[model samples]
Target chain A: MDLFIQLTLTGLTNGAILAMAALGFVLIFKASDVINFAQGEFLLIGAYVTFAMLAQLGLHWTLGLLLTLGVAVALGVAVERLVLRPMIGEPIISVIMVTIGLSSLLKALVSAIWGNQPKAFPPFIPSQPVKILGATVGEDRLWAIVIAIFMLGIFSVFFRRSREGIAMRAVADDQQAALSMGISVKKIFAWAWSIAAATAAIGGALVANIVGVGPELAGFGLRVFPVVILGGLDSIPGAIIGGVVIGLLEAYTGGYIGQGLNQVLPFIVLILILMIRPYGLFGQEIIERV
Target chain B: MLTLNNIEVIYNEVILVLKGMSLQVPEGKIVGLLGSNGAGKSTTLKAISGLLKPEDGEVTDGSIKFMGEAIHHKDAAEIVRMGIFQVMEGRRVFEHLTAEENLLAGGYTRRERDLSSDLEMVYSYFPRLKERRHQTAGYLSGGEQQMLAIGRALMAQPRLMLLDEPSLGLAPMLVLEIFGIIKRINQEQGTTILLVEQNANLTLGVADYAYIMENGRIVLEGYPEDLRQNADVREFYLGLTEVGQRKSYRDVKHYKRRKRWLS
Candidate 1:
C-alpha cells in the first residue's frame, strides 16, 4: 500500500508536467492547425534562459521566471511573423515539415550556445520531502503539481470570459466566419503562438528544476505527443486528463511489472486510443453527410 | 449611401465575373438585387464588404464608395469596423459557439458600445434566437440558423446590411416570416440594406427599388411595381406568362433569343 501511494504521487507529478507541455501543443494546433514540432525546444530555451538568470546572472528565482516567460513570448511572435507567415496558403504537409525543420534549428542553436553538457539547475525549492497520507513526496514535485493546476485554471477562465480568448475560440471554429465578425485571424494566430510559448517555457522551467537542464530536455515534446492525442488535440481539459491517465499508467506499470515498461507504455496506449476513437476522448467529431 | 462605379471583378486574374458592374444604394432604403445563379449578385456584395480578396477574387477595374469614402482597398475587418456587415449565404454561423456567443462575436467591433442593449434588441427581433441562446449554432434548425445569422448581423449596429440569399433553401412560409422581419429591421432601425436574392418576386415585394442582373451586368432597374408591370420581367422573373397562357418550349427559347433587356 505504501509503495502504491508513493508511485501514485510520482506519477501525478510527472503527469502535471506533461499536461503543461501538452496544453501548449493543443493551443497552437487549435488556432493555427500547426503541429508545432519546435514546442519542445521552447521548453529547453525557457529552462536555459531561467538557468542563466538564476545561476549566472545571480537574479532571484521569481525575477528569472518572469524574464524567461517574456523572452518566450518574444521568440514566439518572431517565429510566427518571420517563419510561418510566408508559408500561409502553402500545403499542410509543407507547413508541418517547416515546423520539424524549425525544431532541429532551435535544438542546434541551443547546443551551439550552451554546449552539449547537462547543467544542474539551482535548487529553487528546498529538497526536503513532505509526508502526505503516510507516503513521502518531494517538495518540488508538489509545487509543480500546484503550479500546473493553477495555470490550467487561468487558461480555462481566459477562454471562457476574456474577449481575446473568446475570439481565439471563434477563429478556431471558423476562420472566415471569425473575419466576418471583425476578428483578425492573423492576430489570433500570433497570440496563440505567444501564449503557447509562454506556457511551454513555464513547463520547461518546472521540469528543468527536476531533471538537470540539457539537450535531452527537449525530448519532453516527443513524450507529450501521446498525451495531446489521447486527450483530444483541440481540447484543453483533455490534455490534463490524458496527462494524468498516462502518468498513472506509467507509474503503475513501471513500479510493479518491469523496469523499461514505462517508456513504451504511452505509445501502446496511444495506438489503442487511435484505433478506438480517432477523434480522441473529448475531441469534436466532424460530421459530414452527403 | 453606397455607390459602385464601373467595377470589374476577375477570379484568378483571368476569369472575368463582374464586368463594369455598377449600382447605387440610397441611404435608409432597402434595395433589391435579383439575379439567377452565377450572375455576380453575391460578388457585388462581397466587393462592397471587402470579402472578394479571400477567394482570390479582385475588383480589377472599379471603385466602391461607402458614405462618400473609397472603400475598395480596405480589409474585411476594417470594412466591418466601418459598419458594413454581410450576412453571408448559407447561414455561416460559428457552429461550435452558442447562439448568444455568436451574437457577442458579431459585436466584436463595437466593443465600446453597450452590448447588452444591442443583444436585447437582437433577441427582440428574433425571439427564436433568444430561446436557443445557449444551444450550439450547428444544432439549430435551418430557419433558426437563418434567424441567428441575421440577428448576429444586427448586433453589429450596421449602417448598411448586405444580405445574400436569406431565402435560400427555406420553406415559403419561413421565407415570408424572415423577409417580414427583415423589412421591419429596415423600417424600424432605418438601416440601409442591399438585399441579394434569387427569389425575385419576394425581394421585389419588400424592396422600394430593384435591379435585375444578368451575366454580371444590371440589365434592368425600376420600382417594384414598374418591374412587375413590364411584360418581359413578368414573363421571365415573375413567372407569369401571358395571363394563363402556357408557353411552349419553342416560345421560351424564342423569347430568350429576343430578350428585350438583352437587345
Candidate 2:
C-alpha cells in the first residue's frame, strides 16, 4: 500500500507535466491539422531560453519566465510566416515532412547555442519534501500538478467561451466557411502556434527543474504521442486524462512489472486503442450522411 | 452596393471559369442571378466577395467594386470587415461547433458590438436555431442547418449579403419558409443581396431584378416580370409549350431544350 501510494503520487506529477506538453501538441493539431513533429523541440527550446534568462543572465524568475514566453511567441509567429505559411495547399504528407525537418533544425539550433552537455536548472520552486495522503513528495511536484491542472482548466474555458477560441475552432471546422464569415485563418494559425509554443515552454521549464536541462528533454515530445493518441489528438481534456492514465500506468508497471517494461507498455496500449477506438475516448468523429 | 465589371476569373491560371462576367447589385434590393450548374453563378459571387484566391482561382482581368471602392484585390476577411458576407452552398456550418457558437463566429469581424442581441435577432428570424443553438451543428437536420447558416450570416450584420444556392437541397415547404425569411430579411434590414440560384421560379418570386447566366457570362437579364413574358423563358423555365398550346403529360427536362441566348 505504501509503495502503491508512492507510485501514484509520482505518476500524478509526471502525468501533469506530460499533460502540459500534450496540450500544446493537441492545440496545433486541432487548429491547423498539422501533426507537429517539432513539438518536442519547442519544449527543448523553452527550457534553454528560460535557463539563459534565469541562470546565465541571473534575471528574476518572473521576468525570465515572461521573457521566455515572449521569445516563444516570436518563434511561433516567425515559424508560421516563414516556414508553414508558404507550404499552404501543399500535400499533407509534404507538410508533415517539413515539420519533421523542422524538428531537426530546432534541435540543431539548441545544441549550437547551448551545447550538448546537460546543465543544472536554476532553482525556482522549492523541492522540499511534502506529504500528501501518507505519500511523501517534493513541493515542486505538487506545484507541477496544481499548475498543469490550472492551465488545462483555463484552456478548456478559453476554447468554449472566448471569441478568439471559437474563431479558431470555426477555422478548424471549415476554412472556406470560416473565411466567408471574415475569420482571419492566418491569424488563427499564428495564435495556435504561439499558444502551443508558450505552453510547451512552461512544461519544459517544469521538467527541467526536475531532471535538469538537456537535449533528452526533447524526448518528451515522443512520449506525448501515446498520450495524445490515447486521449484524442484534437481534444484538450483528452490530453489531461490521457496524461494521468498513461502516467499512472507507467508508474505501476515500473514499480511492479520490472525495468524498461513501462516504456514499452504505453505503446502496446496505444496500439490496442488505435485498433479499437481509433478516435480515442473523447475525439470527435466526423459524421457524414449519405 | 456591389458591381462586377466584366470580371475574368481563371482557376490555376489556365481554366477560365468566369469570362468577363458583369453584373450589379444595387443597395437595398434582392437581385437574382439564375444559372444552370457550371454557369459560373457561384464563381461570380466568389469573385465579388474575394473568395477565389484560396481555391487557386484569381480575377485575372476586370474589377469588382463594392460601395464605390474597387475591392477585387482585397482578401475575404478585409472584404467582410467592409460588410460583405457570403452564405456558401451546402450550408457549411462548423460541424463540431454548437449552433450558437457558429453564429458567434459570424460576428468575428466587428469587435465592439453586443453579440447577445445579435444572437437574439438571429433567433427571432430562426427560432428553430435558438432551440438547437446548443446542439452540435453537424448532427442537425438539413433544413435546420440551412436555418443556422442564414442565422449565422445575420450575426455578421453585413450590408451586402451574397447568398450562393440557398435552396440547394431542402424540402419544398422548408425552401419556401427559408425564402420567405430571406425576403423578410431583405425588406426589414434594407440590406443589398445578390442571390445566386438554379431555381428560377422561386428566385423570380423574391427578386427585384434578375440575370440569367450561362458558361461564365450573362446571357440575358431583365425584370422578373419582363423575363417571364419572354418566349424562351416561358418554354424553358415555366415549361409552357406556347400560348394556348396543348401541354404534354410528361414535363420535359429544360436541359433538353437549347438555350436560345447560348446558341
* Interface RMSD score of each model: 1.7, 0.7
TM-score of chain A of each: 0.97, 0.98
Model 1 compared with the native: what TM-score? Answer: 0.97
The pairs that clash in candidate 1 are none
**lDDT (10s digit) by residue, model 1, range A79-166:** 9898888886677688889999999999999999889999998868765799998899889899888988898898889777667887
lDDT of 2 by residue, A7-44 (tens): 99999999999999999999998998889999999999
Residue A252 CA error for candidate 1 (Å)?
1.5
C-alpha displacement of B173 in model 2, angstroms? 0.4
lDDT at A109 for candidate 2? 96
Q: Model 2, which residues run further than 4 Å from truth?
A: B243-258
Q: Which candidate is the best by DockQ?
A: 2
Model 1 lDDT tens row, B83-159: 89999999888787788888888888886745888889999989888899999888888899899989989988899
Q: Score candidate 2 by DockQ.
A: 0.87
